[model samples]
Target: MISTTDIIISICYIAFIVALGFWAGLSGKKDGAAAGEYFLAGKSLKWPMIGMALFATNISCLHLVSLAQSGFDTGLLAGNFEWMAAFTLILLALFFIPFYIRSGVATLPDFLERRYNRACRDWLAVVSVVSAVVIHIAFSFLAGGIVLETLFGINMFTSIIAIALVTGAYTIVGGLRAVVVTEAVQTIVLLTGAVIITVLSWWKVGGWQPVMQVLQDGGQLDKLSMLHSSGDPSGLPWYAVFLGYPVIGIWYWCADQTIVQRVLGAKDENHARTGALFCGFIKVLPVFIFILPGLLAYVLYKQGHLDLEVLRQADGQLHTKGIYSVMITKLVPPGLVGVLVAALLSGLMSQISGALNSIATLVSYDLYKRNRPEATDQQLVKTGRIAAVLALLLSIGLLPLLNRYESLFNGINDVISHIAPPITCVFLLGVFWKKASSQAAQYTLWIGSALGAGVYLLGKLYPINIPPLMVAFYLFVVCVVLQVMLSFAFPMQHTAESNRLYWESPLAPLRVKGWPGLANYKVLSTVLLLMMAVLYWVFR
Candidate 1:
C-alpha cells in the first residue's frame, strides 16, 4: 500500500507538472495562433530540447513496463528494439530531415501531399489520426491506469480519466511547444528514477556477475544470449532481427509523426541532426535502466523474495507482463516509490501529450485548413485544441479493450507491425524514387494495408508463429514490388511543386563541416554505429 507521504509526493509532482505545462502553454499563447509557433514551436527548438523531448516521447510507460517485462521473459534480446533504433535515427538525420525541412510541411501528411498527391495526403492524415487516438493515446492511458491501480488502489477508469485531464489541460492550450518543454523536464525525472531503480536492483541482486551466475545455474543461459537461431521459436530470431526489425524501426524512428514532429521543430538541419543523434544515444539506455531492472526482479523472484506465481506463467516461463509494477510494489521504499510513480506518469504523460499534439497538428493543418484555406492562424489553433480533446475522449472510450492483451508491449508491436508497412513503403519510395507516381503511392497504400490487415487477422485466427517483425518485412517487400510495378506502368504526372520535393531536384542535401574534416552528421552516425556494434558484440 502507498503511504501518505508517497501519496503527497505524487500529488505534488502532478501539480508541478501541470504548472510547468501551463507555463509552456502561456508561452505558446503569446505567439497568437501562428501555426508554426503552436505546432512546431516556432521552428526554434535547440538540440537539447529536441533531443530530450524526442527521447521522452518515445520512452513512455508502455516501454518502461513492457520492455522490462520483455527482459524478464527473454533477456537482453528484447533490447534489440531499443538498440537497433540508432541505425534508423541516423538514417533519419542523414537522409530524411533535410528533405522534410526543405519541404516546409507542418505534418508528415503535408509532406506526402507535396511529394505525391492531395489524396495521398488525406489518406495518410486519416490513418495517422486514427492510429494516434486508437493505438498510441489509448495504450498510454491504459499503461498509466495500470500503474495507478496497481500502486495506489485507484480505479482504472478513474485513473485513466485523471491522467487524460492532466495531460490534456496543457496539451490543448500550449500545443507542441508546451508538450516539448514539459517533456524535457519529464525526461529528467524518468531517467533519475530509472537510474535509482537500476542501481537498487543491482545491489539487491548482489551485482551483475551474481545475477548472471544465478540465471546460468537455473539452466537459463539462453536468456543471457541476444542472438537466437532461426529455428528457435522462443525469442527473437536472427532473421527477424536483421530483416524484419529494421522495417518497423524505419517506420517508427523516421516516419512516425509523434517522433518526427520534434525533429521538425528544430531550428535547422544541424540542430535536427544533432537532436536525432542525441536521441539515438539516449535510446541505448533502456537495456540498462529499464530492462536490467526487470532482470533484477526476476532475480528476486528466483531468490524467493517475490511470489513466483505473480511473475511466472503456468508453462514455467516468466509472465514478464506486470513484473515491473510487481517489482515496484515489492522492492521500492515509500518516498522513492512516489518519485518512481511520478517518473512512470511522466513517461505516460509525455507520450500522450505528444500524440495529442501531433493529432491536433494533423487535423488543423491537413484536414481543417485544407477545406478552409483562408482560415486564420487562431482558427487553426482552435481546431487543433478541439481535435485534441475529441481524441482524448475517444481514447478514454477505448480503454476497456486494453485488458484483452496479456502483454501491452506485444500488443503495441503487433499493431505497429500491421499498420506501419504501408506508410513506410509510401514514405521511403516517395522520397527516393522519382518515378514513384501518385497512382503507385495510392495503390501501394491500399494493397499494403489490405495485406497487413489480412496478415494480422490470419495470425489471430490461426497458430501463425511468425513474429510480427517478420510478417511486417514480407508485407513491406510486397508493397515495394507493387509500388515499382504500378509506377512503371503509369508514369508520374508531376506538377511544379511535386517535381521539387525530391532530394536533388531543387533542394540540395545540407552539408556540414566537422571538427576535423568529415561531416558532423557522419561523425555522429559513425559513433552511433560503433556503439551499437559494441553492444551487440558484448551481448551476443
Candidate 2:
C-alpha cells in the first residue's frame, strides 16, 4: 500500500500539472483568440515539443499497465506492436507530414476532406471524435482508475471522475498549447520512472544471465523470441506482423488525428517531419522500458521474488491487468512509490489532456465551425470547451465496458483493427493515387465501415479463428479492391487544390529539399529505419 507521503506527493504533482497547464493556457491567451492559436498552438511548436508530446500522448497509463500485462502473459511476443510502429512513424515523417503541414488543416478529417470530399471529411470527423473518446480517453481513464484502486485503494469511478475533471479543465482552457506543454513534461517523468524501475528490477534479478538461466531451466526460453513461428500461442507470427501491422499502424501512427495533431502544430514542414522521425526513434524505448519490465516480472515470479495472487480471481483465472501495479508495490521502495504513482498519473492525464484537446478540436472545427463559417474564434473555443466536457463524461461512462477485455492492449487494438481498415484504405489511396476519386472515397468509407462492423460483430459472437492483425489486413485488402473498382466506375474530376495534394509518382514526396546535415528529415528517417531493422534482427 502507498503511504501518506505517496498520497501527498500524488496530490502535489496533480496540482503542479494543473498550474503548469493553466500557465500554458494563459500565456497562449496573449497570442490572440484565433482558431490557429487555440486549436493548433499558434503553429509555433518546435520539433522537440511536438516529438515529446507525440510520445507522451500515445504512451498512456493503459500502455504502461496493459503492456506489462502483455509482457507477463505473452513474453516478447507483444513487443511487435511497439517495434512495428517505427515503420509507420517513418511513413508519417517522409510522406504524410509534408501534406499535413502544407494543407494547414486542424484535424485529419479536414485533411481527408481536402484530399477527397466533404462527405469523406464529415465521415472521418465523426469517426475521429468517437475514436479519440473511446480509444484514447476511455482507455486511459480505465487504466488510471485501476492504478489508483490498486496502489491507494480508491474507488475506480471516483478516480476516473477526479482525473477527468483535472485533465479536462486544462484541456478546455489551455487547448493544444497546454496539452503539449504538460505532455512534454509528463513524457520526461514517465521515461525517468520507467527507466528507474527497469534498472531496479534488472538489478534485483541478479543480472540478465540469471534470467536466461531461469527461463532455460523452466523450458520457457522461447519467451525471449520476438518473432513467433506459425501456430505459436501468441497468434502473432512474422508474416502476420508484417502484413497486418502496416494496415493499422499507418492509420494510428500516420493518419490518426489524436497522434498526428502534434505534427500539425509544427512550426514548418521540416519541424513536422523531423519531429515525427524523432518520435519514431523514441518508439524504440517502450519495448525495453515498458515491455521488458513485464518480462522481468515473470522472471521474478518464477524465482519466487514476487507473488501475483492478486491478479487471479476466485475462479482461479488470471486477469493480469494488475501485473504492473503488483510489481510497483513489490519492486520499489516506499517513498519512491509516490514518484511512481505520479508517473502513472503523468501517463494518465497527459493522454487524457491530449485526446480531450483533439476531440474538442475535431468537434469545433469539423462539426461545429464548418456549419457556422461566420463563427468567431471565441465561439469556436467555447464550443471546444463544451465538447471536451461531454467527451469526458462519455468516456467515464465507458469504463466498465472497456474493462471487460482481459487484455487492455489487445482490446484497444481489436477495436482499431475493425475501424482502421477503411480509413487506412482511403488515406493510402488518397495520398498515392491521383486517380482516386471523391466518389470512390465516399462509397469506400461507407461500405467498408459497414463491412468492418459486421466482421467485428461476427468475431465477437463466434470468434474469428484468424488473429486480429490478419483480420485487419484482409479487411484492408477488401477496401482497396472496393475503392479501386469504385474509382474506375466514377472517374475523378480533381480540383486544382486536390491535385496539388498527392504525389504524381512514388518518388515525388522525396524530391523536395530537406534541411542540411543530420537534421534533414531524409537522414533522420533513414537512420530510424536502420536502427529499427537492427533491433529486429537482434531480437529475432
Candidate 3:
C-alpha cells in the first residue's frame, strides 16, 4: 500500500509533467502545423533542453531498479554498464554526429535508406520499430511495474496500466515538444530524489567511513573491485564487461536511432554536439545514485540493523535481498518515500514518452511518407499520433510478461546488445567506407544478426553457457569478416549517378576538415582515467 504522503507526491509530480506538456503544446501550436514545427520542435532546442532531453530518454527505470540490483549483486564493479559508455559518446562526437547532421535526416533509418538502398531502410525500420515498441518499452514497463508493486504494495497490472495511460495521453497530445519539455522536468526530479536517498542512506549507515568499515567486516569489500581475479561461473565475466560494455554503449549513443535522433533533430550540429556532451557528463553520476545504495545495503546487512532481511546459508554465503522492496521500504521515510517513488516513475515516464514520439516519427516519416509521398503534413501527424497510442497499449500489455527475467536492467541490455551491434556495423560501414554497397550491407546485416541471435540463444539454452555480451562481439567480428570477403568477391556497382546521389544527400560523410576541436575530450578522458585508477587502488 502506498502511503498517503507518497501518493500525494506522485500526484504533484504527474501534475507538473502534464503542465509542462501543456506548455509545450501551446508553444508548438504558435509555430503552426509544419512537420518540422510539430514533430521536431521547429528544430529549435537550445543546449539545456537538448541535454536534458537526451539524458531523460537514455536513463530509465532500468537505472533506478535494475542498476540498483546490480549494485547489490556485484558492488561498484557493476557500473561498467554506465561508465564504459563514455568511450562510445566520444566516438559519436568524433565520427558519427558531424556526418549525421550533414545528412539532414530526421531519423536513422532515413540515413540507412539514402546510404544503402530502400531494402536496407525498410528492413532496419521494421527492426527499429519492433525493438522500440515491443522490446525496449515493454521490458522497461515490466521493470517499472516490478518496482512499483514492491515499493507501494500495489498491483503490478494496475500500475502498468496507470503508467501507460498517463504517459500515452500526454505523448499522443503533445508530440516531441511535450516529450522534450517533460523530460527536462523528469530529469531534475530523478536527480534530486536520488541525492536525497543517497544522503539519507549514508546518514543511516553511520556515514562514509563506517559504511566502508561494515563492508570490510562482512568480508565482502571485494564487491567494490572492478576486476575479478577469476570470472564468475554463473555471472557475467570481467572480460565481457571490458569489451561488451563499450560495444553496447557505441550502439546506444551513436547508432541507436532513438538516441541519435535527438541529436539529429537539434537545430544544428553544434547544439547536437553540446547536448550529447552534457548527457555524457551526466552519465557519470550513476555510481553515486544506484551503486552506492547497494554498498549501503551491504553495510546494513552486516550490522544486523537492516530493515530488509538478507537470506543466508548455513555456511553464510550472501544471498539476495528483496532488492526492489528493500530499496524502498527499508531506506526511505514516509514523505521521502513518495519522492523516491516519483523518481522511479520519472524513469518510466521519460522512456515511454521518447518511444511514443520516436516510433510515431518513424512510422509517419520513414514508412508512411515514403509510401505516400503526397500525404499532407496534417495526415502524417495524425498517423503519428495514432501510432503512439497503439504502441503505448502494446507496451503496457507486455509489462506482466517482464517478471520472467532475472534482472530487469541486465535482461533489457542483453536483448539490446544482440540486436544493436548488427545495425551499428552497417551504419559505420555505410558512412566511413565509401566502397560499401547496398548488397554487401544487406548481406552483412542478415548474416551477422542471424549469427548473433543464434549464438545468444545457444548461450542461454546450453549448460556450457556463454555470456550474451561475448556472443554480440563474436557476431560483430563474423559480420565484419564476411562483409570484407563479399566486398572482394562482388565489388560494389558504384556508378557516377549513385555517387552523385550519395553526395547530394545531407547525411553523406564530410571530408575530414581540420579537427572539430572536441572541447571536452581531455576532461572526459581524465575522468575515465581517474575512475580506473581509483578502482584499481581500492581493490589492490
The top-ranked prediction according to TM-score is 2
Task: Give lDDT tens digits, candidate 2, residues 348-367.
Answer: 99999988889889999999
Give every collision pair in model 1: none
Model 3 TM-score (2 dp): 0.90
Clash pairs, candidate 2, are: none
How does candidate 1 score on lDDT?
0.85
Model 3 pairs in collision? 102-506, 103-506, 103-507
Off by over 4 Å in 1: 31-33, 308-320, 504-519
Could you tell which candidate, 1 or 2, scores higher by TM-score? 2
In model 1, the worst 10-residue window by lDDT is: 506-515
Identify the runs in model 2 with alpha carbons over 4 angstroms from their true place: none
Best by lDDT: 2
Candidate 1 structure quality by residue, lDDT tens digits, 426-453: 8888877789999999888877887888
Q: What is the C-alpha local distance difference test score of each model?
A: 0.85, 0.90, 0.73
Would you estimate the TM-scores of all the predictions?
Answer: 0.95, 0.99, 0.90
- Clashes, model 3: 3
lDDT of 3 by residue, 1-540 (tens): 568878899889887787788778666765346677657777777666887888888788767776777777768776767666766775676567766777677888887777777877877877778788866588778777777776667787888888888888778778788888888889998888888878877788888788768667777667776666546743566788765666667778887766766776688776776677667677778877877777777677667767453444466654342464565777788888888878888888898888888888889988999999999888888998898888878777666655667677667777877887778777766656767777888888777777767866775777345566776676677777777677677777765434543333433333434224554434544465576556546653
